[model samples]
Each structure stands twice: as structure tokens, then as C-alpha cells.
Target: MSVKISLFISVIIIIVFSAGTFFLVSQQTSRLEDELLYRAKIQSVLGAETVATIIEEAIDNGVFSVNEAFDTDYQIFGNFDPPKYHTSYDSYLDRAILSIQDKFLKDDNLIYAVAADRNGYVPTHNTRYQQSITGDPEKDRVRNRTKGIFNDPVGIKAAENKEEGFQQIYHRDTGEVAWDVASPITVKGKHWGGFRVGVELSSISAAQTQLVKAMGLIMILILVVSLLFTFLYVTKAMAPLRKMTVVARNIAKGNELESEIPVTRKDEIGELQDALNRLRLSILIALKRKKGK
Candidate 1:
């Protein structure tokens, strides 16, 4: 009976521990993901505002020809597979906008921050993505992807976004899943393109994984402690009952020697102890009267 009670209490503790651990882990993971997403949104918006200012300065300084940009447009001029584009405006981006893009890349969780024209053409990617071409299509796709048009669903949506902000989760050209936040970039009240900040999901997943492991360890510790406490408590509570069992056996065998069942507790177990003591005294008296007669 004591073992049964201990087992029941241990099961309850395990249920509570499991539920609490799951809730805590889920809540922490959600908070962290929200924080990362918020940072990504801010970086994109701020980056867009800065890049727009730089483009306006270049146009004013005659470094970027606005009319030539509108006329030449995003036309393919190079012979490389996946090709390079021209709008008479890309060179200025390399000189003026690349630094701003690189600055946003320094923020945690962000993989790439770049500006693309309305037609989904990236003028100048960050220095890290501008690796020299190795001519293998597979290698070039991963290494030298600059001057390429990102026409995929997520890319096109970000490039043409005109709202205060736009967000999406999609696969990157480098084949990693990421969260993208984009803000429109305009010059002299005319929409030029959009600026995007890409946050890598692996970074967020790694943090969540570590958090779960820590929580799991804590839950295991708590469970072990609770089980030990249940075992000790049940054993102590059943000690008096075990002793009463031996006293009852001695009375049934008509043994001349029997120990008194004295109990300190005032609960049901103590009541049973008092009743058993009175019965033993009555039987001893009745036997003595019979022998005298």
C-alpha cells in the first residue's frame, strides 16, 4: 500500500514537471524569435532610408545619371551564364551603397543586406557575396551571384514592395532558409527599389536547441528529487501499520508475550492503535478470571 501511494504521487509530479518544462521552453523560444524578427525589420527600414539618401546624393553629384538609368534600364550586356545587367546606375551603387549594405550585415542573425531595383536586379551585392567566378554553374551560383536577377517569389515581392515594410520567410540563393524584411527605397520622391535584410534561421534554431537541452536537464533533476521525497514520506507513514500487523498476529496465536501498540499520532492510524490495545487488555483479564474460578 505504501509503495502504491508513492508510485501515484511520483506520477503526478512527473506530469507537472513535463507540462511546466514544455510551457517554459515554448515561451522562451517565442520571445527569442520575436526579438530577432523585430531587429531584422528595423535594420531593413533604416538601411533603406540611408541608401535612398546616398542615391540622391550621387544623382545630384552627376555620379549616377538618372536619365540614363531610366533609358538603358536593366538590360543584359555580359555573356556569362546567369549574366550581368546594366542600367547605367550599377557602378554608383558599388561605390556608394555597398558600404551601407555591409554595415547592416554586422548585426546579429543577419546574413545579407542588399538593395535591388524594381525589376529584381541586384546592382551590387556585399563584398562577401561578390566572389570571383569559377565558371562551374553550381559553383558560380553559390560563389559569384552578383549582378544576377532574383526573380523568385520572395525576391520579386521584396524588390517591388512599396509599403512601409514587407516581410517573408523564404529560401536564399545560397540554399538556406531565412526571414526577409524589406523596405522601399526612393529618390527625390520617386520609388527606385527596395532594401532587404535577410536573417538566417539556423542562428535562431541553434539558440532554441540549447535552451531546450537546459530545460530538459532541470526537469530531470526535479523529477528525481520528487521521487525520492515521495518514497521517504510513504515509508515513514506506513511504519506504525507494519508494527500493528505483528501485534495482531501475536494475539491470534495466544502468545503470552505481546508488545503494547503506543502511537504518538492522533489520526485514523492512532485510533486503530488505541482500539487494539483495549482488546488485548480485555482478553488478558477474561482469561485470568476464568483460571481463578
Candidate 2:
């Protein structure tokens, strides 16, 4: 076969293999993303249940009233707002929620573990967000929130639906992406609020990118090996054809046979070699008869 034909066949093989590899990698990455989201949702649901249980227990023990714990009225001081006070029961509940948040954060994938009341008031937040406000609006929005109101659409949706769902949010300042899953919190058969668990997707995205790059590298290596083997095999297989072409040219120029065509193959090449030998013998016999006459 011509070099061009050989190279074309190799290119086609490479294309087919590369396409298959790409499809498989894409599927694997998609599954991984789904698993990550699934785990996030489960965590959110569990956290919501735990918070609900704590609140219910506090109420049953008569340590705090449900109405008092969820009270929205803020006690305003004269000029400067004095530090807000929490009953011992409320403090106990807060510590329990904080402990849950800390445990979740240890996984590194979890971004936030928080619960909001029906009115979107977050009574407890992650330990990092529990820090005192530094008077920075942007920073305070993320941190320093015990009785802070978060009337965002996500919070309201979770409270209204009382079902587990997913959400995505982007931070413009940091260009951060957050994947959130929310589940409703119920206390004593009453809809209290919801618990939200957020996962930062930047790490997951980076991991996916790395996986794609690795797959691409493997494809390149396989392609190179395939091409190399194809080139060598094509060259070896066509060497006998090249020899036959040269022998035919000499016979056409009325030159004496220099060497017999090698018939080492048991395939079509061997058959062609036998036919050429017979033709050469017939020509020699005809020339002898003409000379004798």
C-alpha cells in the first residue's frame, strides 16, 4: 500500500480510539459529580434532623419555650446596641449546632452547616461564622450571625417546601462557586425551618480538570504507540511488492533475469510470485524455439 494510504488508516484508527476514550472519561466525571451532590444532600438532611431533635428535646424538658426561642423581637438599647443575651437553654442548643458544624467542616468538602428559622432567621451558624462582627458589611454577611435574618430566596424555598433541594450561588468578589443542598427542620411535628449544607465546587472542578488532562495524556501515548507499530508493519509488508516491481521493469527492458522472485509467503504475494516465475520461463522457451528454427 502507498504511504499515504497507510497513514490515512492509522489516522482513522487513532480518531476512533480517541473518541471512545473521551466518552468514557466524560461519563466517569459525570458520575463523580453526581456522587458528590448526593453526599451533600444526605449531609444536609441529617443535619436538619439533628437540629430539630435538639430543639424538640429542649422544649420537652421545659428548659425553654418554643415561642421564646424563635422570638423575632430585637431588644434595642438607647444609642449603641448592647450585646444580645441568650438564655442558658438557647446557649445549649447553639453549642450543639456548632458542634455539628465543626464535625462537618472536618471533611474539607463541606463549606457551611447552618439552620434558619421559618422567618429566615439563622439562630445558629458554623463556628467560623460565629465570630464577632468586625464592622465590615461584606465580612459580617458571611460571619457574625446568631440571630441574623437571611431572607434570601434559597432560605425561603427550603422553609416553604419543607423538602430537600439543591441550589448554586456565586460570589462575585472571590469568584467562588457554592453548591448547596437544603432540607427542612421540623420540631415536634411542626415545621420549624431548614438546614443548609454548602459545598465549594472549586476543588471538585479542579479535580475534574486534572482527570481530563490525565486521560488526554494517556490517549496521546497510546496514539503514538499505535502509529509506530502501523508504520513498521506497513513498511515490512510492502517490501516484497517493491522488489517485484523492480524485477518486472528489468524483464520489460529485455534484460536477463538477475534473481528469482522470493515466494516465502503463503498468501496472495506468494501466488503472484509463482505466476511471474511461470511467465518468465514461458518467454525463455519461446526465444529458444525462434533461435532453433
Candidate 3:
């Protein structure tokens, strides 16, 4: 009886605790994602605005021609894996866009900071991704990616979004997921491409994995502790019943004064104890009357 009751209660403990643990994990995961995305949007807007201001200043000072910077017609330059392209306007942005990206790359979560034109032409990229190509298709695709058109579905949405900040997620060629938040870059009220800030969620993913493991460890402890507690409690609770079983067996064998049943509890077990005491008293009284007669 003790073993059966302990096992049953332990199962209930697992079910209840499992449900609560998973709910907490799901909520926490969602909160982490929301916070990460919020920060991404802020970074995108700030970076985009900063780069746009730099472009306008250079144009105003006559450092670079605005005509070349906004050129829609591009020329393909290299027969590389991504097909590198060139435009007359790309030279003006080559040097001006690097400083702002350097500042944004200080944060560990930030993967890349770059701006693309309306046609998804990237004149410049972060230096980290601008290493010299090694003539390997797979390697060059991830590294040394510059002067290329990023007109993929997600890239097109980012480059063409002229209204406000927007966010999207995609897998990088480096086998990691990134959250890309973009804000349109307008130069002197003219629409340029958009600036994108990429956020790598590896840290958040690591934290969530740790949380799940900790929860699993907690559940194991609960199971162990609960089973131990239930076993001890059921054993202690059923002790009196076991003793009464022996006493009732003795009484049935005509050992009239074998022992007295104590009514200690007010529950059904106590009622059984009281009934046994009454039966014992009735037997003793009948024996006394027979002796006198």
C-alpha cells in the first residue's frame, strides 16, 4: 500500500511540475526574443540615420558627387561566386561608410552593419567580411563579400522599405541565424538604399539552453525528494493499521484480553479502532456473565 501510494503521488508531482516548468520556459524565451528584436530595431535606426547624415555632409561639401552615389545603372565586374558589380557612385561611399560601421561593431551581438542601395547594390561592407577572397567558392561566399547585389527576398524587402524600421531573420552562410533590422536611408529627402544591423542570437540561444537544462535538473531533484518523502509518509501513516491487523487476528483466535485498541484518530481509521474496542469489551462482558451464571 505504501509503495503504490508513493508511486501514484510522485507521478502527480511530475505532471504538475513539468507543466509549470515548460510554461515558464516558453514565456521566458518569448521575452528574450522580444527584447533582442527591440534592441535590433533601435540599432538599425540609429546606424541608418548616422550613415545618411555622413553621406549628405560629404555631398554638401563637394567631397563626392551625388550623381555617382545615386546611379541606378551598375556594371558587373568579376565572374566570381556572387558576381561582383560596380557603379560610378559606389566610390563616393567606399570610404565614408566604414567609420560608422566600426562604431556599431563594438557590441558582441552585432554581426554586421552596412548599407545597400535601392537595387541592393552594396558598395562597401564591414571590414570583417571584406577579407581578400581565397578563390574558394564556399569561402568567398561568406567572406570577402563586397560590391555585390543582395536582391534575395529578404534583402529586397530591407532595401526597398522606405517607410520605417523593419526586421527579418535569416541563416547566414556561416551557419548561424541572424536578426536583420533595416531602416531606409534618405539622402537630402532622396531615397537611397537601407541600412541594416545584423544581430547574432547565439548568446540568447545559449542562455535559453542553460535554463532548460537547469529546469530539467530541478525536476530530477523534485522527483527524488518527493518519492523519498512519500515513501516515508505512507509508511508512517499505515503503521497503526498494520498493528491493528495483528491485534484483530489475535482476538478472532479467542485471546480475549490480548490487547486494547486505541482510538487516536477521528478519521475512518479511528472509527475502525473504536469498533474493535467495542467488540473486545462485548466479548469480555459476555464471558463475565457466563462465569457468574
Please report, in order, the local distance difference test score of every candidate based on alpha carbons.
0.83, 0.72, 0.82
Residue pairs in candidate 1 whose N, alpha carbon or C atoms collide under 3 angstroms: none
| Model 1 vs. true fold: TM | 0.87
Cα lDDT tens digits for candidate 1, 1-293: 88999999998998999999999999999998988888888888898899888878877888856765443357787577788887687877788878878888787688889988777788888888888877787787777777878888998899889975588997976689998889998878878778888888999999899999998998898899889988999999898998788787787776643466676679988888888787787777887898999
- Top candidate (lDDT): 1
Candidate 2, 15-104: lDDT as tens digits: 898888889789979987888889888888888888888888878888778776565565432221223333334456676678876787
The runs of at least 3 residues in candidate 2 whose Cα sits more than 4 Å from the true structure, single-residue gaps closed, are 74-90, 143-146, 166-175, 254-258, 289-293
TM-scores of all candidate predictions against the true structure? 0.87, 0.84, 0.82
Q: Which candidate do you rate higher for lDDT, 1 or 2?
A: 1
**Evaluation by lDDT, superior candidate among 2 and 3:** 3
Candidate 2 residue-wise lDDT at 224: 86
User: Where is the poorest 10-residue window by lDDT in model 3?
Assistant: 250-259
Runs in model 3 with CA error above 4 Å? 73-79, 85-94, 102-110, 169-178, 199-207, 256-258, 266-268, 287-293
Model 3, span 77-180: residue lDDT tens: 86798888877766667777787786888877788888988877788888888888899988888888788888988788889988556888867767878887
Task: List the lowest-lDDT window of 10 residues for candidate 2.
Answer: 76-85
